[model samples]
Target: MTTIKLHNTRTRRKEVFEPIEADNVRMYVCGPTVYDRAHIGNARPVVVFDVLNRLLRHVYGEDHVTYVRNFTDVDDKINARAAESGRPISDITAETTQWFLDDMAALGARDPDQMPRATQYIPQMVTMIEKLIADGFAYARDGHVLFRVRAYKDYGKLSGRSVDDMIAGARVEVAPYKEDPMDFVLWKPSGEDQPGWESPWSWGRPGWHIECSAMAYELLGASFDIHGGGNDLMFPHHENEVAQSCCAHPEGDFARYWMHNEMLQVEGKKMSKSLGNFFTVRDLLDQGVPGEVVRFVFLSTHYGKPMDWTAKKASEAETTLRKWRTLSEGIEPAPSVPAQVVACLADDLNTAGAITELHRLASAGDGAGVLAGAQMMGLLTDALGEWARGVDLSVYEALLADTRDKAMETKDFSDVDRIKSALIEAGVEVRMSKAGVELLPAAGFDAGKLEGLL
Candidate 1:
């Protein structure tokens, strides 16, 4: 059992985790703002975090981990889209949420243990907003509500920006209702046609930051073991979330460990749909990249490093990854996953390091060991995202062809079972990968046909 140390964005240090409640990991990931189909930028966090989730399950018992990722179904974008499309807000949210799910599924992201919707938690948001106002952390004006930035002493700690610097650096809308330019919206009034909810602060919907704060509280509780998202959210979004949650419950720690993955750039620039450089998860899926390939590309780099997407680059990576599966031809049970691979994953999820180690293991002529090492990382699954794409299955397919004939023509009942047993001993999955007694010696297997008594 390897001890893991994760960089906690809150305290600015990598701390060895001691689960507050012991064995149970209360982890929360900032989920998608469901106003449209999620693009590649969105999928990076999904796969990266899913890897984190996977590593944790492999580290701690899966049943002991409580992973909660929320759906921001109610948002300004959802409202704006509804107005322009003449669709009901609920319809827009539902449609966009489904698109998000479909896109994430395509990228091979596992569904979180809990997916709390903002629309469904309006009451929770209201309760948090009301408490903030009562506690002098938030105020109301002109059918709107604004969170008082001055009230939270350490508001900009997460992003390393001082309060004054943050106000200057941020590109937030300068709404007239705000008491100060730095004061972010807690709730804003909506028109009759727009999405609205009856709240203490006029008839309006919850603001962006408050919704997450409320959702995390409702699902994971006041403080949890870890909270994660993309680096782009460090400021106002996560910064404000820290403010609201801490101010609401002054004595409690909102989230102990904060892990944020870096952004995915496209062609050396930030992935922006407006710039036409953004590709949706579906777009890449259609390009013959397996979901695992996408996950592999993401994990191949340190989660904190900027990853740029290019068709040529993705293709090259697909080839590089496929070379790892070189010798399942003679295998038995799924290769016993290597300990070093598991250790790399446990260490703040240094996926790139783990992959390097995987390649090292593969370059070893020990085919059995290589199979075991790769299988442990869960890279073999097609559900692993686009990483599985463009894999050259030629060699493996040849092995499969040989196995089929072997499983077919055996007239001796005793011989049939014994041959299948040998295939399993070779780490060749009989039903899944290569089945039957069909023997095509790998590039160099003793292809001699042996006549033996069954």
Candidate 2:
């Protein structure tokens, strides 16, 4: 048995992970608000935590681990998108939810054991808010139920900021109805055109933060083993969730451990629509980037650091995966992942380090070991193997070989060089030897470019 260590944001230190219940280890990750397609940044936590989820299941029996990632179908962003498109809120949410599932599937992320939608858990959200109000941690004013931030002493403990400093730094909504500026909304009234449910306070919807606390409590109990999301959620979002959950149910700790993966950048700049680098997971997949390649590139960086996505990295990942696939072709995976690889993953998900070990295994020609280790990290699976197959390079190989043969006799390699350059430009690895020429698709190989080369 291996010990798993994770950096807990709540404690602000890396500690050994000990679940509350060894028989059932539960994890809850803040899922996407389904307003539109999930961007590449959104996919980072999905892949990052998916690796952790796999590790947890492997360490514990598969049946013992329960992963829950929620869908925030109720949000201002979803409402605005619906208003802009003149579509019903339900229609927009449903379509976008499916789109999210499809996009994540393309990235090779497995669906969580329980994916509770915010809409589906409306009753639970209402019940939690009612309990908060009854417990004097929340109050209703002008049809809005707001959590009393001061009521919870450890309000700023997660993000490590005092309430006064947060009030000064944050752009809080100055509503005349609220008692304190730091107090966040538990429930807000919905317009007639907007989505809402009848609650004790009014016909309203749950605030962005309350949805997670309620849903997680409902599905994963009052406290779970691990709670995770991007570090960007560490501030008001996660902070508010902690305050409400702890106040609403003081008997149990909210989440035993907290994990936050760092943000993502593209080409050394933050990925944004204004920066012209903002693209969805679908955008990359549609542009001919395989989902496995995307997953590989993501795992190349540590989750705690800002990962930069570059065309060059994607190209290299594709090439490397192709090589590994070839090396492990027709070889059955070993019964278990290499101990070295498991140790790396257990140390706060050191995927980059694990990949280095995989490279060493490949170099050692240990195909069975490489396959087992890569699969442990959610790579080299049969499902993601389609991208590497179904392409015939024998024709190009013969053509390059014939050109090399002629170049040997004529002593003018210009024509051969031209053909080789063309193939290389199309992302084909050109190998010319005394025996013959071998052509294999490298990163970003375009089969269409090979049409006229032969």
Candidate 3:
């Protein structure tokens, strides 16, 4: 059996991964808020955890693992969007949820075993809040329920910040509801127009942090093998979950291991709308950037490192994938993935290392090995291969060859240059050699642009 190691953010070190139960390995990751399209930054954690999910399935039998990523269908952001658009909250969440699924599928991610919506788990959340109130970890006042931050002695252990430090450095909500400054809401009162559920405290909705704790408890139990999300979620969101869950269920250790992938950047700068670099996964896909190329660029950097998205990397990734697809065309994968690829992944999910070994396999001319290895990393899958067939360039290649042949005889390269320029304009790379002319699709390739080029 291949041993897997992962960097446990809670422990602050890389540790060997051992499931709580060999028969039922469980993991929970924080999912999107579903108010709008998922930005490119939001897609990083999805792909990173998807790779981890695949690795676990490989090492353990596929049936033995239970992965749960929740959908935050009820959030203030959703309410805001509903109010602004004059659309019902349910309609907005449903549409955006499907959008998230489609965009992720385009990037070759497998849906998790369980995708629990927060709204579906409201009864469970209310029950958990009741238990917390009974246990003296929470209290209700002014039609609101708030968790006592000081009740949990190890409140900041996961984030390694003291409560005082958090109050100073973090954005602590200052509400005059008879509570300490650091106390967070377990449930808050909702207005008549806002989305709310009937609760003992008031007609309200669950707080942001309580949503994950309750849903995780109901689906994955109190003690799960792993919990993962972006590092940006480490401070308040995850920290609050740790506090609330442990206090509510002291018998369980919550999540045994914590994993957090680093934030993403674009062109070596923070991605922002002000910079005009912010874009969503759908935006890139619509612009002719193959989802596989996006996944490749992501795996090119380790998950723990700050990933920089650039046009140059995308172009190089496309070229490499095209070459590998050509090499492994019509070849069945090996019975198992390459050992080196698994080993690289086991070492704290060293995806970049796994990719390097794949390069070696491609260089060795082992087409089957490359195919199996790429498939394991959620690349080169049958579902994501449609982009590889953008437009069959066979006819175009033949036309270019015939035009060049005529130009050689007529001592006039005008027609040859015209075809080459049109192909380049259409984002196709025309390679003319003494042997032959090979046309390949490049980045931003649009098949519609080649309508009149013939």
Best TM-score goes to which candidate?
Answer: 2
Q: After superposition, how far is residue 314 of candidate 3 from its true place, in Å?
A: 1.8
- Sorting all predicted structures by lDDT, with the top scorer first, yields 3, 2, 1
TM-score-superior candidate, 2 or 3: 2
lDDT of each: 0.75, 0.92, 0.94
Which digits, one per residue and each the tens of the lDDT, describe model 2 over residues 249-298? Answer: 89879999999999999999998889999989999999989999999999
Q: Candidate 1's residue-wise lDDT over 69-137, tens digit each?
A: 999887778878888988887887888888888777765677899999988899988999899999999
lDDT of the structure predicted as candidate 3: 0.94
Tens digit per residue, CA lDDT, model 3, 55-104: 99999989999999999999889999999999999999999999999999
Task: Give each model's clash number.
Answer: 32, 0, 0
TM-score of each candidate?
0.81, 0.97, 0.94
Off by over 4 Å in 3: 395-425, 430-437, 447-454
